[model samples]
Each structure stands twice: as structure tokens, then as C-alpha cells.
Target chain A: MDAYEDLQQATLHDIPRSECLQLLGVARVGRIVFADDEGPVALPVNFRMDGESVLFRVSPASEMCLRLNEAKVSFQVDRLDDFHQTGWSVLVRGTSSYVESEDLPVLRSTRPLPWARGFRPVYVRVQPTQISGRRLVDD
Target chain B: MDAYEDLQQATLHDIPRSECLQLLGVARVGRIVFADDEGPVALPVNFRMDGESVLFRVSPASEMCLRLNEAKVSFQVDRLDDFHQTGWSVLVRGTSSYVESEDLPVLRSTRPLPWARGFRPVYVRVQPTQISGRRLVDD
Candidate 1:
């Protein structure tokens, strides 16, 4: 029971994972970050949350996807408006994998696809380990 | 002058590095991506641009800040709206390094600080490699 208690305490103190998915649902475009031996890279991706995971596509020969799926990855999605001084963000850490075409249909209806060419859209999915989020509550 | 001509040709085909600053000048918040051994991560940051680099801050111990600045980094400033389905994005690939207090003046005055906080905001500069960008012109 001690380990269970500790896990509960940590999860309680941290931002809820569900909030991260909620924020992702509201945002259609956000940047994805990847870290590899070469260094850290951030790129803009049009994404939609699939269940608890994140799904997005890029052109073939994508440098970001190539690195992300090959390593433990983290994706940060945030939206902020300077004028309003209000915004929210969500970050997910996990391993990324390529989403096969056979699995696309279940995701397509809910996922907001980018305007970029889709005929060969290479999809990448990030399965989360820990998810956290923050937001500036509007007055 | 053949080398210069070749360079000029490359610039013509790609977005000029200087133009990045120009586009940044008109924007206030940008998405920042970082990675640390982990794959990729992205988040929105309230930032401004220097001549060839972009600057933003994070709180002490912030995951985004720590994971980034470890080595080669990439930050992107982009805008997308569903209605028009068109927007421009600037991706900066550079080493993420801290700007100490002594150097703040030079970095601060390069552009107005749109994002600040009571907590000591760690300043980071992203020097870019390729600054190519595209938009959905007719979408």
C-alpha cells in the first residue's frame, strides 16, 4: 500500500493527464519536439488526439518523424494569445511509433488533418508515459 | 563569384535568414520545440527575435527549458487558422544557449519583452540553420 500511496500522491500533485487530451482536442495545430544524439528539434505539426495518444502526419523522408519514432519522445502542444495574455499547454512524454494505414480509419474521423498533401501523409503516434498541462485561467 | 552566385541561388530557392527576423517582428508568441535524449517536444512560447536567433524564457526547473539548450535545438514560430487554412511558419535550428544577466541588455533591446515573469525567466537563444517556410497559399 505504500507504493500505491506514493503514486497517488505524485499523480495528485501533478497536472492531470486527461487535461492534456482536452487541450489537444481544442488545438488542431501545435509543435512536436524530438531529442536525439544530434540534439533537440521542434517542428510544427497539425495534430489530433486519438484516444490518449497523439497522431500527426508529415511528408515522407521527414527528419522529425524519423528521429521521434526511433527514440523516446515528448510532444508539447500549446496555444497562447499575447493580446489576451491567456493560454494553455500540454506536454506528453513517451515512445513514438508509426501508425499503420489499416489503423487510419478509426482515427480519421476525429483527427484534424493538416492541409498539407495527404496522399502520402506519414503518420506518427506518440504513446504517453506521463502527461501534464498548465493554463492561465481567464478572469 | 561563382560561389557567391551559387549561394544566391540557394537563397532564392529558400527563405532568407534575415526574413525570419522580419516575420518574427510582426509576431508575439511562437511555438518552441526541444528534445533531450528523448525524441521531440514542442510548446508555445511568448518570444521575440534577435538578428539571427529567437529568444524566449522558462521558469527555473521547467522541463521545456532543461530538455532544450542541451545541444542542437529547433524553435518554430508559426500561425494557423482554420477558416483560411493558410499561415506562415519560421523554424529556427540552432544551439540553445542561455543569456546571462550581463548579456540581457543586448538581447532584451533587440526586441521588446512580451513575455516575462516574477520567477527568474531563463533566456535562451536559438541560432538557425535552414529557415525554410511555406504556407497554404490557395487552401
Candidate 2:
């Protein structure tokens, strides 16, 4: 409605897969989205990129460990600037499953460390079938 | 594994609905989780708490405008402290519908302003069927 509002206008751009992966690799925290009996749920998790998949840990007794195995899920990471009103978000759609027992040793040494206090021994990996991202910037 | 790791142990607590609503009222940004044709997706949006509902605006042509109307969705808002490893997250699960036209004038004056440049004329409101939250604090 005013000149400042015009200045606040932004353009949205599609980020390529490679760039999306790069962003994911650098970000340490993201929201993992999945459905429960009620509906969709999004919860934050500390994550690390393992090749093209996302690797994180949850408590073996947690609902995530119980419901996420082999389920279609989405992982979202973003950097938002409230002052500048600019940001980018990447979404990874994939199937989540427990990491194989054989890979635990190496992954334990190299994967993301959970920030929560309790033991998060069950490692889950989301193998993305589709990765997409978008960026919003001043026009 | 170490003394510092032991110090980093956090305790998780269930926050009551009153506290969750209080937190939601003060937060300006959140992720909306909904299912598309592919699966679950979480996208960041600037939103406001409307009574017990969540209100946000999106482009009429956007997928959110099309898929979110009359759809069951979840809106999640959180505050994370990477340094202290403490945070709280609140989730609202409910059905979304376009804000009725008659109430637009008054609602528009008090609603959350979208940061992105573009016309966001379609106002969507998610009326919560359930609200839950949790907090992680240093033990």
C-alpha cells in the first residue's frame, strides 16, 4: 500500500538439488515432519547429511523410533531473517528407516550428536526421494 | 561420554495447554505441516494466533491455498537454544479453512503481516482440535 511495502516485495526462486544439498549439509538443526494417528507433526531434531540422506537419532523408546521406520516423511531446514524478511527453506521428502546395525560404529563416530540429555541410540535415516528448496529475496 | 556431555543433559517436560497458547501468541513464525500428493511437507510461514486458531495468508495460486483449505494440518512453533541446549516447541493440530469474507476487514487490521513480497489475499485459519507442547531444560 506504500513505498516501503513496495520495497519489501520479494522474488521467490527455486533452488537446485545440488544447492539444496549444500545447504542441508551446513545446517545442523531441522524439523522432521511425519504423520501420527491424529495428523501431521513437525518436530525439531539435530541432523547431519549422510550423502543424500539425512541421519539423526531418537530415543529408542520415543514415538519417532516407533512410528518413523519405513514411513514417508519430510525434513525441513531453513534460515530466516526476520529483520530483512529474507530466507531460504529446503524440504526433503523421503522414506525413514533405522540405520543398519553394521553402519552404527562409523556413524556413531561421524554422525550428528543429539543435543538432548537422554540417550538417543536409535539412529534413523531419511533417504530422500525428492529434494526441493526455495529462496525469497528482495526483488 | 565426558563431563561436559553430562552437564549438557536436559530434562524434557510437558507444557500445559495454557502455556502453549501463551507461547504461540508471542511467536511470529512457525512451520505448517500438511500432506500434498507426495507426502508430508513442512513450510515456514509467518503466522498469528487467533484465539485458539492459527492464521496466515498465502497466495491464491499457491499450493498451500489450494491444499490447505478444509484440510487437517499442524502448525508448529518453537524456540531453540543451540548454546544452552534448551528449548520449547508447541504444536497445534486442526482443520484449516479460509477466513470468512465478512470478518476480513477487522481481522486484516490485526493479523500477522507476511514478510514475503506478493499479494497474499487468501487468509487461512487452522482451528485446533488439539494443542500440545514440550520443553527441554538443563537438568
Per-model TM against the reference: 0.75, 0.91
lDDT, each prediction:
0.64, 0.85
Q: B1-139 in candidate 1: lDDT tens per residue? A: 1122222111112346567678777777876666545455666667776666777776667776676554577777777665555566777767778776676545434543433333435777776765766554542
Candidate 2, residue B126: the lDDT equals 90
* DockQ, model 1, C-alpha based: 0.26
Tens digits of per-residue lDDT for model 2, B83-129: 77678999899998999767544645467678887888788999999
Candidate 1 overall lDDT versus native: 0.64
Worst 10 residues of 2 chain B by lDDT: B1-10
lDDT (Cα, 0-100) at A129 in candidate 1: 86
- Candidate 1 chain A: worst 10 consecutive residues by lDDT? A3-12
Model 2 vs truth, CA RMSD = 2.4
**Model 2 interface DockQ:** 0.62
Alpha-carbon error at B115 in model 1, in Å?
3.9
Give the per-residue lDDT of model 2 (tens digit) for A1-139.
4334555576788999999999998888898999888778899998889889999889988877888989999999988776777899999999999997676546454677788778877789999999999999877
